[model samples]
Target: MTYHHTQYLEDGSIASTLADLARAHRILELEGHGDMSMGHLSYRDPFGRGLWLKRGNLALSEVVDDDFILIDFDGNVLEGTGLRHIEWPLHAEILRARPDVNFVGHSHSHFATVLASSTEELLPYNNHGIWFAYEGVPRFADTCHIITTVPLGVDAAKTLGNAQALFLANHGIAFVGSTVAEVTLTGIFLEKAARFQVDLKSSGFTPILPDPEEAKEKFDRIYPPKAQHNFWTFFNRRLDRVEALQGIGISQISLPSAV
Candidate 1:
């Protein structure tokens, strides 16, 4: 059953989770990682049977304390401020498909869009891009308008199986992380990697590559995203201060409100 939003304010427990998500979204928006309101970021609350999320659109910049909407594993609006993201399935299904994840960030990053429009994988063009080494990126060349259906989200997530990132044809890229910080940072890093590739292509020069073992070592350093689950907590406290000044005072963080 869908968790309908009526008159329930996110309690301290749930509010803490929303605090993290809203702060993270604000950071991504401020960084100009994606267009305004075009990208979506979500985190699964540790409570509410682990079927709750903090998402939908409500101006990432203005989102403040306890302004995150909670949803089920099925993308149905449970509690928050607005309608779910157009590609709600993209976040819900993938989270369901992969129990290991807590954060899912979807955006039409400029560099990612450029690379997505191509048939190539994001190769390691520098020490930064070394993350995409021999581990080629998977592409979803469907050119579909939007992933509004569960099946579509499932298919796309499957295509991205076991990969750190994905390049969606004629669209953009998707980066998944176990935490909000990691997911947000990975999205940024992937764009950097894509930009490196684009620059090299423009110069018509082959960029030097790092050795396999060396790349693996770097990968391990960035792994576990700061002790697994802790990454989410780190950003939660960091963003709370920013949201407080935005005037997003206490309110029923209804789905429609936060969304």
Candidate 2:
């Protein structure tokens, strides 16, 4: 699983992709994915070498294109330099298990983690929940320990199955998708949907969930490739405004209309 060449490091396309990955980190941070540098994201290398993981010791907001290290499925660092996260196997095994998944993210966002500790299911209560309506979010209660080993990673991946996301019981969340836009939005929407469920329960009202068939139809109509691209664009624009208001420099990353 080791790759020798570092030629991809200089590839402009790869650099741009990493830049988008970095933006995803920061965007998620703004949307409550910030857990004081504990969470991480990964992109399956275009060259088939390995995944480019966010190096440890930095908060999600602190990540940039140069902050990633290329590591193989065996957890060996193949390129770049930094202390790797102990949870590398979480990203490695998921990407290895899902050929259609190019991007993966793990975070301890408040609501999602809160809902993960409860027995209630995530229903299609709103648009945010609609994305996951077809394949309900599954829970992985195997162990709360860090997924640092191959077997544990494999088991977590098994729990994930065909779902776009998984709840790691009382731990955090793991989400995967085919592109950066899809994965990042999935994380954001999952958190929002969980927050709504938590609030609904606190209100002591029995919430009505949308019909399964109707939810599946809505999911198909609203989550097409073009819609995904539009959602990503909206978030990037929102991020731009946030940076402006905070007096932070705009990201130099040349984001594409779609990832």
Candidate 3:
């Protein structure tokens, strides 16, 4: 079946969302989760159509509105020009499998990768980590080969079933969300949680794991949908001030609320 972003292109929401996504990538880079150049963030088409992803040539920090390309579930590049990420299937398959998910983030971020390679469980040592307690995160234990093939992506998606995030063994972390803000915030927090967990372990001190019940209560109170919009606004403001964004046009784009 032919797929296109015609609906999103006309509505203009896609343009705004693409800018936000590029900003999210830059934010991840500034936070040091970019892993040199192997990180990506994508959004499902507004009409539940295709996926919008960054071209492989641009660094996460340098992504702009024009850097995004549209693709179908089979990884075929439907629009735009340039190299598609070899891991495109990872996003495509997961979006295909999870109708609830609208955003996907992947990064060989330092802390998360280190934690994933270890035998230690990602314990809930803090509020940031406690959020994962609502639904335990899964680890994709398959081979760490580049997920260039459709089958490989499908395997990764199977491992990620119904969970918000998944750690690829010896690889990195992939996060999914029902909206851009949720996924972006979760990605940021998850990276923070990894840092906290690793730091405590390295110090040889026993960390206090948050009670699941209390954690749930705290999560509900602190991270309702509205909180995501607040976060998006805060982060977008930060992006606006970054020196590297001078020519990126993100500041000029009137980004719609990410809720």
Candidate 4:
């Protein structure tokens, strides 16, 4: 992962942040967040310029540090090359609303999108589901269309409130956190939790959810800051193995050849 020194990447901290953002893109892609080139991730500029977003026209798996463009709240690309995602406001207004958040990610993960289209709430049937059990995952029902306007973004942010993640009705999911690891993990776990509920429904078996107090207690004991760091480290190592296999000429995917 050689980072080319660009105007934004010249700053060590900014470079490292974007590097993490890029890695997060790939990590989420591996964890079932890929939807062609539609999804995106962003980092709030430390200097207060705006959010440094993953540029458009690239899939999550293909995002490198150089693929970012620094865009202000008004959709102005202040730095870097490539076109900015029209959903820039999705990141902008969230950062504006949540002073504590520094990272934002949006993706149409499979199970999450399925759960979003349905009225079913995410249950704490698994460890992954417990992360959002206390705050409760809220659905942004204002619109299922792309969040391209400031007002729409603001509405989405309002729906998000202080929760770590939001399900966009019939669309995707939005997740925010104070760091890249937390944001990325939110995206990953949200998808996993959604999958659990969706699959449990498909199994035709009633799910026995944990008590709310017990779930919150487990979340506190298991999801400490150190656990988040450890999970991030594990994902990075997993990514390393995948990339190493690709380096050896193994394809990340395989399909039967057409007749």
Candidate 5:
């Protein structure tokens, strides 16, 4: 457990806000019931440079301020005890190409994983699926792995462009957001959409794609910015309580472990 972000907030500035956002995604990755220590949530530092991201494959239930790895925009491990996620390139690659993006969340969520196992787009059955991506999703069918190599991740990022979500075929899910809270909610809704897709497939009713106008209308409202922040606000307070109970102090969290 090499914890890079020991203080939770670098300065007293945005301390509570930053910790809440960090803890929100980690908690969702835990409560959304995904496999722990595998998925992650990340956000670019606004009012500054560098990024705050999860050190991959750590137990979500055990996530502390130290588990958050702060890195430069260029993917340097700016601070933290543990090595960055092997897929760090993807985070930098996407953020560099899309400045409008504030956060990116990825997970090997169950329903989305099924699509990764197939050769199909996770199309919208209604407004819920389209709420994140105004202009339908872009599925990268290429054969790449881990985003370990720099150029490989860049090319994939180029293919992504402005889409809110990209279903990486034979891989996993990528969600872009205007904030950590937005992306976190996107992950929740994405999994919900996925579960609905799976259930509909089981029910044998053809999904009626929403009209373009309707899709645009819905995307703007469902989990809007304020609502996203509000949900994160509530969720992270619960997490902070847990963090307090565990006594996740800088001394305990700052040291690195096997990870």
Candidate 6:
């Protein structure tokens, strides 16, 4: 398939967006979500159907504005240098399939990988875990090999369906969202929730779970526009504080009211 070598102009919104993407890497590292250079995050390019993702094999903390690459649905590197992630197809096919999703994050987070290796699925044992309780997060029950092929990416996207996240069987986690904040927050909290469940189950006791109906209710109220705004602002402030000490700038960018 043919792909365009798009130019990324660091203009108003694009500049702000790239800065947030850089800060997201730092936040993920601070949360212990980096597994060597295997993890990646991507957002749909505002200019086209292409995606902007960090270069391959770069530690999350090492990611910068120049590290971002533009690639198409065919996994062709249309812009920037350095290697692209081996699993770029995971982002490509998903974006092609789901118009609602603009941000995608894939990680081999410790707790998330551990939980995926088990037969048991993540249970909503508490408020933080409740968001995943409804459909119980989809599982891509296929091979654990890197999704390097378009067919593999398509299969993964099929498994994701309408869910917000996918637990790659015996691998890791892939999450989707309409905004960077939503995906980042979900990815972090998903790992935390998995860790909590695994620890609780290891105690050899039954953990009480919230009712599905009530859990969905709470999720609706807590994961809306207002809540995302508040959470994103709070985390961005933390990022700003860290960057300030190093003489870097990360302007606070707000999520759109609709996302």
**Clashing residue pairs found in predicted model 3:** none
Candidate 3: Cα lDDT at 4: 28
TM-score of each: 0.75, 0.89, 0.87, 0.91, 0.78, 0.86
lDDT of the candidates, in the order given: 0.63, 0.84, 0.77, 0.86, 0.65, 0.76
Prediction-by-prediction clash tally:
14, 0, 0, 0, 5, 0
Name the regions of candidate 3 deviating beyond 4 angstroms: 1-12, 244-259
Native-to-model Cα distance after best TM-score fit, residue 227 in candidate 6, in Å? 1.5
Model 4 has an lDDT value of 0.86
Alpha-carbon runs more than 4 Å astray in model 2: 1-12, 247-259
Determine which window of 10 residues in candidate 6 has minimal summed lDDT: 1-10
Q: Write the per-residue lDDT of candidate 2 for residues 1-259, one digit (tens) a residue.
A: 1112232223448787787788788788888888877899999998999999999988887787688999998999999998999999999999999999999999998789988877778888989999898789999887877788889899999999999999988899999988888999999999989888877878888888788999999999988987887788777767657766663323233322211
For candidate 2, the TM-score is: 0.89
Pairs of residues clashing in candidate 2: none
lDDT of 4 by residue, 1-259 (tens): 4222232223459887798788899989888888888899999999999999999999888887678999887889999999889999999999999999999999998888888887888878899999897888899987779899999999999999999999899999999889888999999999889887877877877779799999999999999998988788788778778876663212235322211
Which TM-score value belongs to model 1?
Answer: 0.75
What TM-score does candidate 6 reach?
0.86
What's the residue-level lDDT of 47 in candidate 3? 76
Which candidate number has the best lDDT?
4
lDDT score for residue 124 of model 5: 69
Name the candidate, 3 or 4, with the larger TM-score value: 4
Estimate, for each residue in 1-259, the C-alpha lDDT of model 1 and write its tens digit: 1121221123435565555556666666544453655677777667634344434556555555565566776766677676667787777777877777777877776677788887766776575576566455788776556778888888888888877677778877777776556676667667777777777777866667667777777767754445433534443444445455553322223211111
